[model samples]
Target chain A: MADNETLDAKIEALTAEELARGLDIFRQKLGAAGALWLQTCVHCGLCAESCHYFLTDHEPQSIPAHKLEQVASAFRGRYTLVGRLAPALTGARPFDRDLVRAWVDAAFGRCSTCGRCSLNCTTGVNVPAVMRAARATLTEMGLIPADLQQVVTTALETGNNMAITREDWLDTVQWIEEETQGAVNDPAARIPVDKHGANILFTVNPREPKFFPLGMQASATVFYAAGEDWTVASEGWDLTNYGLFSGNNAEGGAIARNLLDSMDRLGCRTLVIGECGHGFASARWEAAEWLRERPGFRIISFLELMEDYFRQGRLKVDPSRLTDRVTLHDPCNTVRQGGISEPQRSILRRCVTDFVEMTPNRAENFCCGGGGGQLAMAQYRDRRLQAGGVKAEQIRATGARVVVAPCHNCIDQLMELNREYKLGVVIKTVAEIVADALVLPTITPPAGEDHDVTS
Target chain B: MGDAGLRLGVAICAVLAAVALLLQVVRTRSFGTRPPMAEAQGSALRGILYAFGPGMAPSAKESTRTHPVVYALGVGYHLGIFTAFGVLVWSMRDAAAGSALPPAPVRQVALVLTALGMIGGISLLVRRARGPLLRAISIPDDYLANLLTTAFIALAGLRLLAGSLERALLVGAMLLLLYIPLGKIRHCLFFFPARWNLGRHYGRRGTFPLRH
Candidate 1:
């Protein structure tokens, strides 16, 4: 990955033609909602405190409104009468290299697109949407952070961000399936692959197979305990979408289409997105918009599915099995943006005995500083960790020994923050915690009726 | 200028402002929002109600809680602006009809509200200039907009108290109305829609009307 200096040199080398193309893409992406947000900002500065990046450094440039000014300035200069006549008065600037450089840093380096500022904005400006427009523009200019762009390129080329092959993915799944069977003490416990007519088509972040296989094992254990008819696709199994972060709708649409095709192929009743915040958001919220086609199957988060299982009494969990003081780190995409706030809380309450709430939990919770592909952008690692000080403090204040963050991206960052800040805490996923508390139901054969069954 | 000429100037500026703002609304709509293709998990209406209702309450957002005085000043400033507009319309009607001024109680209430608004406007303007965060985000248009509106509010209050600054007040109103579509003052029109858009986006995701 290129450092900031190299990236700056590349940005400086942008040709006039490239800048024009970027501006054209910017105009195309600034639809009504983006226009509204750009126009509505009142510069009240109240949003300054709501942003983790701004709070970390108190730099004026880090302020959400100031960060968005990069895009707003260009929008004004191009579209407005006063801006055309007297750009200085409105702070409008032409779409030039300087603006692009500022935009790349502000939109990609500083912001997580967490939407926390939107909630606090006095005029209700959707700050993140405007930032995304800036990102879309930069993406076209080929100015995406090198590592981040690589992730997107990897996904586009190999069907998963990690570029895991069919062989490797199958190997990981089989390994987790065996682990699930051992943990559940049932030979019939299975992680089915591409099984037709399955009730749920479970998808996972490529990170699960490439690095964090325990998350897969945990999910499989829970599904087995609930006796779910679930299958992981042999292809299109990676739920995480880099397009969401890359701001490339076409690429995002392609990824979403692959999942839709996989669902159709398996004939699943539902598409249960695994514990990836942006992945859940990409599938449940943005996929249809990207594809311009409504999915035939129900799209839900794995957390929501777990909540449903608890509600239906299909899964029994002994909360007493886990006694560690636990606090939940709400992923911004899943809670604040995706609206899957309560389900995870519901699942946690049922799966843990000592649960503590972070001071500002739920939609107001701070970002773990790894959203918007920050984890993938190695160039921004220091800035990301610095901005994560807020979340680190939130966790420390909770005094919890264990932190449960449902999203893999967040888990990765939080784990780093734990080491960086020396917070001395274990980070686990909701599925992992629930797996610990899972109580397998005793199956008493009904007068030898099921004596020869798989169990 | 003569009384008649001042009144006519104010009227023309108001009309032009309205037409310009309407055109802006059309232009904004011209960018046409993509109809959400996903299945909605909650009612957009419910979310919109929350956005305009409880969502605006100080308790509902950290911004307001942290800056209660600034929020109050903003609220008062807007209220005063609305009240000044009402008084302007009432004065125009009475003048055209050759009738007496508003009842003393109505006049007094208007005076009090406009006075609060005038103070809010001045205070906010000062905050904008003094506060580093606000100053950094502000452009020339912001300060100009605040100045024009604050001046208009002050003149309106003076007209209510002394009933002699009608010409000055009319000129202030005319300048403000003319500047509305040319600067950040247009946010007066975009605020509601922006809030609506925010609500609808979150509502569709079942995030707003926030469930506990």
Candidate 2:
């Protein structure tokens, strides 16, 4: 008991220095757009209902505006004269251990950084940006949950969050390649690795090779059907970055640089991100910002590539086989933030005979409660599950037998929701659905040639 | 006659408010000027238009649609505040030239609008105080700002109803005008730029002009 008290005293003593540094980091984050958001909020509380956390728990602390105050109030104390001189007048409070702990939980655990509340903000305050500043500050103070820190550390050390070895990755890929060939009844099918000058350099959620190898197989089958030349890199194949989740810019930049270097080495034309929403959205769009350089080649999601194939009439799929009513859960990162909403719907429309949309679908869809690294942070699992109830109800209302989410995280969470809620639905990625209904053309491509379509 | 002092006080307060607001604008702009590193996927012009245009439509937002009455009241309150500002300028112009008040018809219209705004503003305050979430999120500045603005609007309406209250109204307006930079009410100055940046950010991401 004395040792525990001593440890607590040490932690409490560290707060003052940590807070001063955290304030500096947060102040640095407060660029013009961020400052405007911080200053413009009126505390109108309209965003309370817009937050899934508040919706589920009805806790005022779950209010998006209050979560923002955690960051903005600190800024107020440090930057504003009124806050400096008369802190109470402006609701500014000095940082302490309790404040830091509260902010870490509210900013990282309770919230999904889903960008939902911002859509309804009357003054158009960017709630997610403010939340991100809080996360970044907490990260600077080394207050990130152990689970999130482990993911970031593993990614930095092992080039993937799951720490899967090259031998394991290769074995899984080769086995899936064989399985895909047998499933398609075409011995020529392959999941090419390290092929030079391939049209597409594909990256998948590490979860794919680690646990869900069939998901990668489905994606490869679609590429094979389209007769497209694609290769996965032996190095830097993990496209997902926990940095975005952890609010560590350096880690995110490193992840982007690694992928760009890999793409350059392989001489691939397009970087195709796989069926993971946040990873696809972050790497394809946001990573460039962290790296601050244009990645010479185009970045495209697998959904977009499939949509292109469908538009070009290259890959034929028999939708009659997918007769169950299917509903799509738009991943917040991919659809709302990434702007890849239409392509998934377009793919699903052709890939499924019966396709329905969840109410308030598209960019406005509720999160699957697994985003913002919630799935990785075990401490927040109960809160995540409760927040997911909003999405569960939306799916239940659709009465769809199959739920098609193009995001791997959403798929994982929805699978859990299905079991918990007894929704009696199967969860599938867009690629998996396409793979299930793919119709192989009569004329096949040679084993090692770029696709040449004349249709 | 002695209203010149009141009119001069309002002018001085307005000038101070404008100067403070300008410094804030400069500080905010200086930080936000870093160009976005991401490639633009959609037209920023379209996004700005959507942000100010249809985006402001109550139907375009869930909060607005869910609480249409509160949204309408809030909109009405802002309209009243803007209208009061116009009255302040008009009354000041008349005092400067030592001219007569505007035709009673215009005064009546102004009076009705300012009264409506006061009602909206006061009801919003009551609502904020009553709700658990609102009370938790609100700071002292929120209540003070709303109360001051609502009181100013009420004073303006009373002055329009009876010209004898002009001095009180001007004093009330001056207090709000001076306090704008120090409190939450200053959202008036930042609201447009905030929305513009929002439009640009969302617009660049192809998330703006939010398609159904």
Candidate 3:
């Protein structure tokens, strides 16, 4: 606690002028939206436990509601008389460096910005919106935590969240294509690239193209086998918006704006987002809302895409390929924010014979530790999994060995939970199952020799 | 301004509410709450009831420990709205004595309530907008809730201070009954019921029972 005071002093000592300048920029950028958030808080704390930081740590300060108060009260004290009275009456304290740093960690790193808390809040006070304003204020002050700084720099330079180079992105896709051929015997599967006017534009998180290419491999094989007229963007198409991780909506908007406009330019009908929870949430939810007007493009998750394929008879399913009993783990963004759970159920029903339902399967789905950019933050690793204990227990109750999460973030966190708890459960991507079980049409080759990747 | 106006106003409001309920009822049946069923009505009722009883200073349904000033202010504000609304109701029968809902004395009380509620709400809003992490996460709805609630209160005060009591009464009643089903006002009714249902389900499952 003594160490905390030193840092607090350092933060408090910042000139009011500097703080004012940052606030000025925020005011200029925020305009009416800023005022709206300032006017709406009713002091109900329903959003407290929705935060992973608060849930895992059980710290009131970490709760999204409390965090909002810290920033909100300061705003109140400076601007409104009643706000002043409440703070004075209610122990409104001043901000210090320690509080700022802690807030950075909790709001930016620990919480996934899933917007679940906002949905549940009675007053409709969006905590993430307040958190983003605070984030911009902090960011302007050059107080952004180093790790997130690194991610932003990487993303700006590489056009991917993990900062994968363009060459690496292509190479990763190539490796996945090869693996797809080896696994599904479809080398000439021909994953379309920059194919304008395609019906679907499939996108993956940079992680899929970097470390876990298997997810990409699975999705590619599934799309090909299902005879999808899908294409991927060669430039500015990386959909995982890290700006969302820091609650930086502008950068998030910038990241997603390209894809939305790209879809328009390419004349695509729908978007098949990859297996990312926050990426899916950020791209499909917040960023789209910020487009000033609706972008007129519809987004469907890969799982939902699979569900549509089966419902439309675009793909024939064979459940025999999936050998174990499986239960569905709905990623919060995919379920709570995305509203894409039925397709998940449909995919499971078509791909696995031994299927069981988790108690909270849909909108009330527990968040994966990796969602809301919690995984990207890199500091809250333990809290991410520990906060996920409730979710693990839900799965355990199902008595299923294979846990199929339709999200990349869920898959990542579930993988860690599998090792930590040793629940004897293996996590599988929905894409993996759908691809393995999907019936594919015979691949026709030109006058080719025995060397053929497409089966 | 007289019994006729008052009767007509309530009838119109009742009709509007019926229409809103019909739409919501239809929507609830078709799509409902996307996927997982939450005990929103049940939980909200429980939360509100618990609030009245043990009334976790800041309310147990909420986890944040707001300033007691804020809580008291909130209670005061809601009470003001309630009283102000009551006065307006009385106005419907006696036009010159007042206009729509209640008399001058009753409207006065409503004004006070609206004022108090606005003070507390605006206080909280300003605090969050300028404060640390909250201002960061605050979206438009958050500010808009306070902005509109305050506006309604200010407008109530203005109308009482000047405008025809009947006009104020009609607008107030229509807004309360009509928008309650549409906007954030849904919380007043939803808070208790939603929290109650959530508590029941969680309790049955041996999940966390929300205690004040």
Q: What is the lDDT of residue A28 in candidate 2?
A: 71
Best to worst by lDDT, what's the order? 1, 2, 3
Q: What ordering of candidates by TM-score runs from best to worst?
A: 1, 2, 3
Write the residue-wise lDDT of candidate 1 on A28-91 in tens digits. Answer: 8778888878888878788999999999999999999999887889888888788889899999
Q: Write the per-residue lDDT of candidate 3 for residues A1-455, one digit (tens) a residue.
A: 33234334545777767655654554543333333443344455556655555666766566666666666555544443434554553324345444566556555655666655654454445456556667766666666555665676676666776766767777767667677776666456667777899999988877677667777888888887777898887766677776766656566677777678678778889887888776776676667545544557677677778777788888877899787889988787666555556778877888888999886556555676677556654556767788778677788999998998877777878888888777888887888778778777665445644654543
TM-score between model 3 and native: 0.66
Clashing pairs in 2: A32-B31, A32-B32
TM-score of each: 0.96, 0.95, 0.66
Which ranges in model 1 have alpha carbons more than 4 Å from their true place?
A: A442-455, B97-100
Stretches off by above 4 angstroms in model 2 are A1-15, A442-455, B29-33, B97-100
Query: Cα lDDT for residue A225, model 2?
Result: 91
Between candidates 1 and 3, the one scoring higher on TM-score is: 1
Q: Give the interface RMSD of each candidate.
A: 1.3, 1.4, 12.7
User: By summed lDDT, which 10 consecutive residues of candidate 3 chain A come out lowest?
Assistant: A30-39
Candidate 2 lDDT over residue span A321-434, tens digit each: 989999999998898888788999999999888999898988788998999999987778889999999999999999999999888888889988888888999998999999
Model 1 misses residue A390 by how many Å?
0.7
Q: Rate the local accuracy (lDDT) of all candidates.
A: 0.87, 0.85, 0.63
